[model samples]
Target: MDLDRFTRQSETEWRVAPFGKMRVPAVIYATEDLIRDMDDKVFEQITNVAMLRGIQKAAFAMPDAHWGYGFPIGGVAAFDPDEGGVISAGGVGFDISCGMRSLHTGLTPDAIERHKSELADALYRSVPAGLGSTGKIHLDPLEMDAMLEGGARWAIERGYGRAEDLERIEEGGRMAGAEPGNVSDKAKKRQRKEMGTLGSGNHYLEVQRVTRILDQTSAAGFGLHEGDTLITIHCGSRGLGHQIGTEFLKKMAIAAAESGIELPDRELACAPINSPIGVLYLGAMRAAINCALANRQIITHLVRAAFARIFPDARLDLLYDVSHNTCKLEEHWLDGARKKLFVHRKGATRAFGPGHPELPESLRPIGQPVLIGGSMGTASYVLVGTSEGMGLAFGSACHGAGRRMSRHKAYKTWMGRQVIDELAQRGILIRSPSSRGVAEEAPGAYKEVSGVVDATDEAGLARKVARLEPVICIKG
Candidate 1:
């Protein structure tokens, strides 16, 4: 957090000059205060990332950069396979493909108020939540493999959601290269009953109301209105993702020595992209991505069913689904030529700019929807990718208001009952099995989302579309 450690490149950009063992410089996009507020671990991790093999461009961090397991949570680094690129397990995080999925309810804020409590209770009863939660539907070994391979498409085929919903999902709800066989049996078993369940810790199902439109054009394109109510689910591949990360992190750590790659940090364990171990990790990681997509799809179905029980005529359509903490093979323009690179985004969201071929046809003109969830009892934002961001960050943006304090610190300083009561006083409803969980996610435990989004836009990572205030929050 020492400003003297970095040289100012511009108002929003800070540079760490490449030195000892670093292959490239590290760059961070943030305002002066945000940078000063950032944890020192972030700078250390970014510099470590720069020393990795085949690193293309500078290792970068978004405005929400904060200390994480290995890399800074809001980290972005691309590596070229042709240049002996290495795929890092730490860069992907433990909860693989953890993401946000937003739904558009065809009702206004006033309509939600009429049956808010009923809807909240209904959702709580219908959607399994909290630690070790299980859903009504269970997957057998064969069915689990199918779900991991087919993703949301398989869930839709099994009557979870509509066929049309796939259009709004990333990779059409199924990431390529998913090999269920590559995943460990233990990992698959852990996820057997977790689908459609919102596992604890940062995962939640929130109902929000659009309070303001920041960009009329993009907001219109995204089917947004001032008072429209929306529901957003934030989760990941449950225990399966965690198991894969734990298993592979150890494998990569051992392989790093065998492969003759010097690691600046042991936590940044990695393997060559073409190595056998790396290939297996990619296959297993892709399966985890599909698991997350399928999980969100099933949760969306449960949300619709819960809403129907309250409002018979209610219609909740998919807005967009995006995953963070992923390493995607994407084509990015660098220097003068287009190169295929494995872009690792940890605690960051992909913000593919307008007209990118990877986007769905309907959203191509406006670019991909970037869902930015705020902390508990806070307001979230919707943003769209911009051409400027594509040029700057390989079309990447901040995922949320990154954590400002540790969970342990929060529990020591605040009480769950007080936090819940304070939020309730502000007309925000909170429902959770664990009172301590609520305190750990207190709004004060995170950086200001508005400032993060403003810095993101100022740095040309993404353009804000609409701001949404939480009406009901069902945290895990």
Candidate 2:
């Protein structure tokens, strides 16, 4: 957090020169104020990531950078397999493929206000939320393996959503290279009834109103307009992802020790990309990604059903869905030649710029939609990837208004009832099973989301498109 420790590269760029054992420099993208407010642990963790084997370029942190397990929460790093690059469990975080999904309602705020309370109750009753929540669909061992391999596509085949939604999701709703055999029985058991459920802590299903458009062209391309109503779902693989991460971290640590790899931190446990353990972890991790995609797809079905009961004429269409956690094999041009690298993005979003072949044809000229979720009752923004961002931090950007304080601290600072009442006075409705969960996710616990988005835009990580304000939040 000390400014003296870094050399200023620009208004939003700060560099920490490589010191001992570091393979490259460490870079953080943030405004001066944002950096000053960060914890010192962010500095230590990012520097530790720089020392990891086969790291390409520099270890980079986003505007919302904060202290996390091994890499900083908003860390980005790429490594080449031929250079002995390692796959790390900590670098991908426990909630594999945690991400955001937005939908178009094709209605105005007036239409929602008429049935706001009823719609809120309908959604609350329809979608299972909070800790240890379970859904009606319980998958058997065979079905679980099928879901793990097929992802959202499996959900669609089961009548969860429309076929058109696949184009809007990452990996066409199904991640390849997933090996269900790599997933443990215990992990599969934990997820049997978790599909279509939003688990606790920072996950929610919210009805938001488009309040402003920053870029008319991009906003139109994304089907956004002021006064239009929208829905956004934020969640990921539930207990299954946690179990896989836990199991793999231990396996990787032992493998690393046996292989004579020196880790800067115990939490940075990893295995060589060619190693058996690493390959197994990737297979399991990819399955977890599919679980998350299928989970979100099922939730979208529930949301559509809930809306039909309230407004039969309402239409819900997929916009874009992107994950912030996981390590993915990708191709990037490094130094003058194209190279294959495995990019690890922990609490970071992939901001692929315009003209990238991976994007859908309709959005190719506009680039990928970068959904920035805010705390409950706060404003979320829609941003587009910029060409300039492709060369910065391996086409990665911040995930959200990173936590400014611990959840415990926030709970101690404000009571749940008081927070709910305050938000209600501002016309925002909050519905949740746990008042304690509401207290822990108090909006004040996070940094100003606008400021984080502004820094991201200034740093060329993404371009702002539109702003959305929460009208109804189903907290978990």
Candidate 3:
């Protein structure tokens, strides 16, 4: 936190030299105040990431970087498989491919204000939440396997969402090389009835209105405008992703031991890229990615159905859906050559620059939409990836306003009931099953999203396009 302890590269950037087995440097992008608020463990964890096998460049942390399970939540590191790179469960986190998706509503803020109460109640009733929640769709073993393989396409086939929606999602809603056989029965059981539900904790479906347009040109490209209504869904594959991560971490520890790979932290259990265990984990992780894609897609249909009930003429169009946690195989020109590398983005999002072939055609010129979800009762932002990101941090950016305090700490110090009432008084309608959760996710628990976005833009990770404020929030 002490700027004096780090080499001040810029007003919003700091560099820490290699220490304790680190193969490269660790760079953190944050303002002086932001860095001062950072948890000490983030620096330690990020430095450890630099020591990993086949690390091509420096280990970087975004402005929202915070202490997490293994890697710092906002950490980014790319490793070359050809150079004996390794995959760490800690690097991917438990919620594999957990991400945010935004949908545009063809209504103005005034239109939503007229029936806000009824709409909020309808949404709370329609969407399932809390721990152990289940929904109407229950999958059999065969169906589950197909769902894992098919991803969002499976849901569209089952009449959950429109077929055209797939194009707006990452990997077109399904990542290839997913092998359901690598997924355990226990994980399948956990996901059986979670389809079309908004699971608990930091996850929600919100009705929002665009409040500020930062870049009019890019905003037009993203179909966003001030006062236009939109919906943001934040959730993941539910218990299935957790089960898979838990099950694999145990296996990878043994694999790590057999390979004589010494990890700075036990939570960073990993295996070499060419190792049998690593291959299995990648296959299973890809399946979990599919699960998350399918889950969000089904939830999208539910949103459409809810809208149809109130406004028969209303149309909900997909903006973009991208994962925040996962390792991706992407080619980045490094050291004067195009090399395929395994880029691990734990609590980060891929901010592919303009002209990248993976971007949706409509967004090619503007670059990929990077949605940054805020904490409860705060504002989220829409940003676009910049080519500068490709050179600075492997096309990665912060996923959210990182928590300033842990959930446990927040619960112990704050009152959830008061937090909820205050937000409601401010015209933000919120519905949650647990008051404790409301306290844990109190807006004050996170860093200012504005600060995070500014740092991101200055750091060349992403450029702001629009800012959105919540009108209705269905908390998990």
Candidate 4:
């Protein structure tokens, strides 16, 4: 936060000197104004991440970077196992696979304006939300295992979504190496009836209209044009992912001490990547990723059904879905050789470049679609991955407009009722169980989304394509 103490790399980039015991220098990508607005603790936490073992390149922070449990919420880091890389629980936050999924609505905004209220009501009724909300599907232990291993595919098999949907989802809707046995019974119990439900806090189902086009070629490739309607779903693995991260952090601390791993911060407590504890955590984390994918998949079905009521011929086609959390074993060029690295992206989206074999066939020509959610009443962006992203960040980008103030601060400073009324006046319909919840996610509580996306594109993390403004917001 002290601009005078750091070296300026650009208008939106800065470098902190090598601090005590840091293996690599730390770099932060944020406008000078945004940097000054950040809490000082973010610098401390990012520096702590720089001290971690086997961390490759630099400890990087995105434009939306903000103070978090350990790593900054919008942090990106990759570790090499051959160099004694470690996997930290704090690297991946409580909301495992908390991600965004966008659906392409072929209709223009004019086509849906007449039925907006009807569609919003239908969506609010169809999708269960709010704190402790449960869905129609309640999975038993045996069935839950199938869901964990199957991911969205398991749901598609049961008629939740079409097979074509898998091609647009990250990892084809199923994360490899998910081990349901590693997840505890309590965590499983919490998620049993939570499938297809949108949990509370910064999560919502939004109806948006493409308001601007930045790249004609990319926009055309994505079937997006100004005035086109689209649906964006934001949520995660719900209570189960939090439980998994909570239970394992305690176990990892003990493992860290036993393994003689010296952590600069207790929150960075971790285990060797190949250790028994690490392997189990990875397996469990992947299972949670699947849970999130399955959760979003079912929600997609609900959104489609809700739209069908208003527009009889409406069919919601998957644009793209991506996960923001979890440590993955990926092959990247490191130290001039192709070595497998364990990439940990906490609050970061994987921005795979064009022609990457892993990308969905439809997206191969245009690159992966990076959905960056904005604060309520703000403009969200549709970006595509680039080769520059691969070189700069191992193909990673900011996930959202990061929190400017904590929820506790937002609740204390703003009136929930007033916030709801303010947004409603702007033609944004908000449906939530608690007025206080609305206050906690006030747009003022987040950084300007356009600024964040601008920094992201400048940093070569992703290329901007289109901008989306919410027409109706269904909150939890």
Per-candidate count of clashing residue pairs (backbone under 3 Å): 0, 0, 0, 0
What is the TM-score of each predicted model, taking all chains together? Answer: 0.99, 0.99, 0.98, 0.97
- Candidate 3: RMSD over Cα atoms? 1.1
Tens digit of lDDT per residue, candidate 1, span 187-282? 998888898999998999999999999999999999999999999999999989999999999999999987778898899999888889989999
> Where is model 1 more than 4 Å wrong at Cα?
none
How do the candidates rank by lDDT, highest first? 2, 1, 3, 4
Tens-place lDDT digits, model 4, residues 192-310: 89999999988999999999999999899989999999999999999889999999899998878887888887888778787899889999999999999999999999888888878
Worst 10 residues of 4 by lDDT: 4-13
Model 2 lDDT, residue 134, Cα = 90
- Candidate 2 ranges beyond 4 A from true positions: none
lDDT of 3 by residue, 1-476 (tens): 55666888988779988877988888998888889988888887888888888887888899999998779999998888888898888889999989999999989887899989988988888888887668899999999999899999998999988887988999988899999999999999888888878888889999999999999999999989999999999988788899999998998887777768888887889888778888989988999999999999988888888888887787798999999999989999887888899999999999999999998788898899999999889999999999988888899889999888889899998898899889999999989999998899999998889999999988889999999999999998
Residue 248 error, candidate 4, Å: 0.8
TM-score of 2: 0.99
Looking at model 3, report the run of 10 residues with the lowest lDDT sum.
1-10
Alpha carbon lDDT at 348, candidate 4: 88
